[model samples]
Target: MWWFLICLAALIGGYFIYGSFIERIFGINEKRATPAYTQQDGVDYVPLPTSKVYLVQLLNIAGVGPIFGPIMGALYGPAALLWIVIGSIFAGAVHDYFSGMLSIRNNGASVPSITGKYLGNSPRHFMNVFAIILLVLVGVVFVSAPAGMLTNLINEQTSLHLGTGAMVVIIFAYYILATIVPVDKIIGRLYPVFGALLIFMSVGLMTAISFSGEHTIMPGFQFGDMFSNLNPHDMPLWPALFITIACGAISGFHATQSPLMARCMENEKNGRFVFYGAMIGEGIIALIWCTISLSFFDSVDGLADAVSHGGPGNVVYTSSFGLLGVFGGILAFLGVVILPITSGDTAFRSSRLILAEYFNLEQKTLKSRLMMAMPLFVIGGILTQVDFGIIWRYFGFANQSTAVIMLWTASAYLIRHQKLHWITSIPALFMTTVCISFILSSQTLGFGLPMQISTILGFIGSVAVLAYVIKVAGKHKNLSHSDKATDNLTRIT
Candidate 1:
């Protein structure tokens, strides 16, 4: 109990102190015109109020992630506490803030654009493909997850019967509508309502846990007992836990999503609240789910059994239902179903913008938006029929892999300007190791290699990446000087 309380306190305190330090490091300017103002196109680049942008960003990055991801992460026991708190403060929030600020610096460019400017053309092209695939996967997963939940709700609570296939069509229709319309038309208007539900459910769950009696509900998880793997499968904690908990900790997907809000932000200073602060808000939500999942079950084994039997949805449904009864059922619907739908829409929206930017097409008109969006939805709709677990596992891997690229890109940006680069550099190196090891050792992707060999490969990969980044930075510096010398000689001549 003390450990949980302390972790919660630290996260809240870190947001004000550590978050402000990051803000200073980024050197945000109040007077400079943002892309939303200078490049307002009445479509994707329209300016939004600070409050609206903050809410939309929060809900956009969140989706069903904080709920489902943390529930699964809790399979490792209280170690999740450490990851959510530390990762959110040092890694997740920092990743999000820098990514958003970088987008603003680049005329509201997508992640691939920013990556191209800093990491060069080849990596940018790779990232373009990687981000588009990840977004489409997100769209598929969100659609399937919510529709399945809605089907379950109807079957469980109502006499009116609806199959998942029907729900899929209905949800996909709404997704297409949201994706093709103007940002202000669908996402900007509805996200606030969904955001309010998220806040209400998180706070309500926290309150329920607080009052449910310490001995029974709050089982007093300790920091010292956190290291012993509570997972029934004895899953390695290094990469699996990190990948399982991407959203509440550090996610690459946030970088793709940030550019959308970046296009709407009114000022550079608001980056902290919209980008960094929204991540902290997500961390809080993930923490609540983590705590509730652990405390609600009789033991770690019981939680694991529930998850194995029914999936993370079981945790959401059982915990919320037990704690708040009928009201908890409603909260589960909002948290699990409504939230992901919101994120799915934005995922497709970001995909549309990325495609528009890639092909150099105007998005100011409906015809152009529909032309880019129809193919994405067709693929996403096809994907909803594939196995959900496989899609989710790949999404998690791609999510962290993208984070490494974005982090390195940010590091290169800082290095080129001669600012402190270690902040992004250290995390980039760490996540790079995690992603590489997960690939080499994961049963789904890799050969399920031994942990020792995986660790060794991770070490080599991290070193190689760091060497490449340093070499590139040096070349960029030299190129800048060479261009400067040429300009000087030409002026003098």
Candidate 2:
């Protein structure tokens, strides 16, 4: 519990200290008009209040991620604590800040466009396709999980005629309507309500933890304990820990969501609060969930047994029900049902924006918006029929893979402008290692190589990629012949 409080404080303090420092590095200029104000498209580039944008962004990046991921991540014991704090401060917040600011600087362009601008055409094209696919996977996963939960919840209550398939169709209909409409219509208004419920649920659980008198549940952290896997499967601590806990720490998908808020931000200064602050807020939520999950079950082994018997959803349900009784059940429903539904809506919306930006299609018109979104939703609907585990597996790897690309792109943008590129470059290289190592070592995919071999190959691959990026950035600088163009890009946008 003391460890949990310390981590929570560290995340808050990191926001004021490290978060502000990153903002300074990015050079937020207040005088310049943001895309929301400058472009002012009624459909897409509408300016929103800072508070609303923050809530929308929070709900966008969060969904069920911070809840489910951290619960599963706690399988590794105290090591999850270290990653949530350090990764959120240095890696996750920074990744989100730069991605959002970069989008704002590029007229609210999608990640592919921004990446293309810095990393050149090939990577941009790749990011365009890759980001869309990732978003689609996210959309499908969120859709299926929540829709199924709702179906069960309803079926259990009364003999509802609705099946999971019918629920999917109903939810996807809402998703389509939300995706094609203006930002402020459905998402902007409803997000603050959803965000409030999420915060309420988190606070309730945290309060329950404080008064539970469950001292025997949460174990003290020790140096030796940090290195050992507490998970039943003995999952390796390096890449598995990092991958299992991507959202609370850092995730590539945040880059995709950043532009959504970027388009709605009324001022460049708001990016810090909306983007970086939201990620920090998510870290706090993840931290709370981690502690609750570890302590609520009486022991890590007990928690692992429950997880094995049910799933992460079981962890959430049993923990919440155990701690808060009827209220906890309500919170459980929100965590399992409402959270994922909200995330699914934004996932599809972000997908629409990605494709629209890729094709330079205007989203103000109904026809254009539908043209960009119809096929994407169709594909997502088709995928909802496939196995959720397969889609989730691919999404986990792909999520970090996209993060590697965004980080390197931000690093290149800094390099071309003669700024401190290592801020992003270092994390980029680190995540590169994580992604590569996870692929090589994961049983679900890649060669089931030993951890030692995977670690070595991951290190080599990451450094090589970093070197290649540096070369490309250097060549781009030489060809462009001036930092003036980079400066102009920001100024004009």
Give the TM-scores of the predictions, in the order they appear. 0.95, 0.95
Against the true structure, candidate 2 has what lDDT? 0.84
Provide the lDDT at 459 for model 1: 80
Q: Write the per-residue lDDT of candidate 2 for residues 110-138, one digit (tens) a residue.
A: 89989998888999989988998899999
Who wins the lDDT comparison? 1
TM-score of 2: 0.95
**246, model 2: CA deviation in Å?**
1.2
Question: What RMSD does model 2 have?
Answer: 2.3
